[model samples]
Target chain A: MSLDKEKIKHVAKLARISVDEAKVASLTKDLNSIFKFIEQLNELNTDKVEPLTSILNQSLRSRKDEISDGKIREKILQNSPKKNEEFFVVPKVVE
Target chain B: MSNITNLSLSEILKSIKSKKISSLELTQAYIKNIENAKKLNAFVTTTFDQALENAKKFDNKPNNEQLLSGVPLAVKDLFCTENVKTTAGSNILNNFIPSYESTVTKNLWNNGAFLLGKLNCDEFAMGSSNETSFFGNVINPVGDHLVPGGSSGGSSSALAADLTPATIGTDTGGSIRQPASFTGTVGFKPTYGLCSRWGIVAFASSLDQAGPMTKTVNDCSIMLEAMSGFDDKDSTSINKKKETYSKNLKDNIKGLKIGIPKEYRVDNMPKEIDELWEKGKKILKDLGAQLIDISLPHTKYALPTYYIVAPAEASSNLARYDGVRYGYRSQKGKDLIEMYENTRSEGFGDEVKRRILIGTYVLSSGYYDAYYLKAQKVRQLIKKDFDDSFTKVDAILTPSTPSSAFKIGEKTNDPVSMYLNDIFTVPVNLAGLPALSLPAGLDKKGYPLGLQLIGKALDEQKILNIGYAFEKNCGYKNEIKKWWS
Candidate 1:
């Protein structure tokens, strides 16, 4: 129920966020406190209850599969931190 | 003309229509006030030039038929305004400008309302206090050094200080209502899917909703009608005929059954908040509404469930922010994985990182069943409790917050203490129901307090009507001094 330093590091890795070595202890403590508070939910029995995913009782509304609008690649790429001719630039992955 | 900024959103529209004041004059007055009240730190970005140009255009060729003709309003930065920066109060998005407009803001502009600025908020709408904002904490206009409740603190502060005629803020979990309660203004969170989420910077997909923060209940109704509608872009948007909230607003609660949930009386609740609830009930009774004692047994689990579900969704939504497409990217990373890690670490604030980590932890393979799944079931129970209570009562009444506005840095170190501030307001979001917070009285420290009205799903009119009645009978008026200037 409590998150240790190792587990905190692991969670950060899973989240793709790098945690500083010095701040790991404090982060672990904060997560543990929050989990301890969240542990109160264990008191209730939910064995047969269905998870409520959406609040609306209606089923998802569907529309025709058609392109509504497009053709503005430059506008779409305008906010990119790094981009070139028509694609976003990122650090190389494939060796 | 002397105090144009003092006019309500509704009054401003009326003046513009009657030619008593041109749109340019109204916009100028608000800009002047915003310039003088920079100490409040309410605005993250002010669009003064754009606002003035639009006001001049509106004055030259007025359109009085629109719902919000020639009105200038500020909105939370969480909403993406095309070509204008929408930070969501994070350093990662500090320089990012949107190419497309959010459905809600677009709706405002389409109805003849122009943008005044983007107000500050908790980063990705995560924190209970505005301290989580990368732009810095917004000072409550009511008092010196008082914390304006978050993540819609900027909207509440701006509205309270008359910097904006009215504003809209997104509420994932008590963001709009809590700040409104803290600032003695009116804030309403419409039913889930009542407002489109398209183009909004997502925090928690299921729980996030956009609503109005205004100086009065009438303005809240007017603004809500203007800002909410179904959009094709947001799949979750409710496809129903939009109600004329302003036109149908009536204080007729002759035989309406209002629920008084005893479970909301939490341990260690301040005496003034409890007294505020009682005063609210007395006002309803005086308005000829019957009050019934109701039990929402699962009310206590709302906050814990919220912390889990919201983060889990946030982690999934925020994964899109990795350094590839948009937003901040780390120059130090040599490879793609390292780039994402470094970017997130350097870009996000402490509170945002904490939530993302908590979200990551809950949804991890081993803990998914125990944490995320269990929390969802608890969420079901919480919603069911409201479902059962509503069969007997038309709406529910509770205090908006446990206490009035606290000093800055009072509970920032302790996250749970900060989360507890939304204990009374979070349940409404969990159930996806409508709720409004109206200033009812002041605490012993003279800070304003609010009482909430919870309505059934898609029943915003009911709550707004009850709030309208309460506003008439409570006779509470906020006397905020202009000390920040």
Candidate 2:
């Protein structure tokens, strides 16, 4: 149940968080402790129990598919870290 | 004028309507109080000038019809305020401002409350103590070195210190109530979806609920009235006519059945907290209510279930924060993937990064059924426990926290110990029920201890009324000395 340094690095990569090699030992220790704490859930018998999908137990409300509001692309892009001409600028994705 | 800041929201409304005080005068008084109390580090962003401008506008064209009536209030930084920098107490969003307002803040403004500022919180509302805030940890005004409970720590601290007339905070687990209990204020978490989550920085979407942290239960009722409603934007919002909690608030709970959940009496609970629970039961009994012993067998599993479910959802919700959209961007990355990794690692604090990692680990392909799905089933059992108890009693009562506030840095290194702070409060969130915490008495250290009243889904008025009765009879008042100023 304990995560090793390799697993910690793999999870970090999946989470898109960078973990330095120097810190992996401590991360492994911390994540292992948290996982150990979470292991107590294994004692419960939930074999026949249904997973809870919603708190209110109601169907999701839906609205008609129509254009509700638009025409303010500038406001939408106002908080972008890098943007030009109605699109956010990221490191070039295309090969 | 010196005592103007001490008035509650309802009192402030009365004063403004009767011409006994102008909105400008009240706002100035609060501004002075906030300025004098800078050592507490309760506020991340203070919009004093804008607050004063709004106050003056209210004074010029008086509106007595509004619920808040020009009261200047601060909210947890997790709420997105239009054009205001909403950091959610993380460095990644340190410079990010929302193009639109959150539905909760918008509702408050529509009911005539204006923003005083954004208060500090645990980063992304993750940690139990405010120590996780990237800006800085908020000091509880109750004592010099004591930590304000988080992630709504700043809201409770600010309200207790009279920095704002009243305030609002979101509770994913014990964020609002635990801080309120620590600071000797009143905090209420309404049923899930009672308050819209649109524009709120999501933590655990199913469990996160915004509620009031006020100086009195009456004020809590008033603030709740102004905040709760349905929004078309949030699909989960409860589409029902809003109840008038303030007007219906009554101290008479005669013939009401209250449940005393035996399972909440955790091992090694402080003597003072146990006594406080006993005292709360007695007060309710003296008020003509009947008490029944109840059991929620699955109570002990709430924390572990919460850890799994909250992180799993948080991992998915937070995936949107990759360097593509708004927020912090890395200057060190050579490629897109590296950019996201570098930006998130550098921008998020240690606690946030830890939760993200745990979330990512639990929801990974091989472990999803063992961790995430199992936790969800356990969560259903946790909810069922409450549902069975509610069928036997009108409301449930328990200690708000295991003990009083701890010193800053005391539990910072131990994440499990920090998670234990929300034991009693987390189950209510798991079940999506309403609960309120009011100061029952102070512990031996003169720190405040609170008693919680749990209610059925969407039954906020019931808990508020019970809290109203308890506050009237308990005779406990927070005698916080303004030593910070």
Candidate maximizing DockQ? 1
Segments of candidate 1 deviating more than 4 angstroms: none
Q: lDDT by residue for model 1 over B1-485, one digit each (tens)?
A: 88888877888888999999999999999999999999999999999999999999999999999989998889999999999999999999988899889999999999999999999999999887799999999999999789999999999999999999999999999999999999999999999999999999999989999999998899999889988988878988999898899999999999999999999999999988888899999999989999999999988899999889988999999988886678888898788889999999999999989999999889998899999999999999999999999999999999999999999999988888999999998889888999999999999888999989999999999899999989988988878999977
Model 2: what TM-score? 0.99
Evaluate model 2 with DockQ and give the value. Answer: 0.84
Interface RMSD, model 1, angstroms: 0.9
Model 2 chain B worst lDDT window (10 residues): B1-10
- Chain A TM-score for each candidate, in the given order? 0.94, 0.91
Residue pairs with backbone atoms closer than 3 Å in model 2 (clashes): none
Q: Report, for every candidate in turn, its global Cα lDDT versus the true structure.
A: 0.92, 0.92
Over the stretch A1-95, how does candidate 2's per-residue lDDT look in tens digits?
77889888999999999998898888788778888888899999899999999999678988899999999889878888899889999997788
**Candidate 2: lDDT of B414?**
84
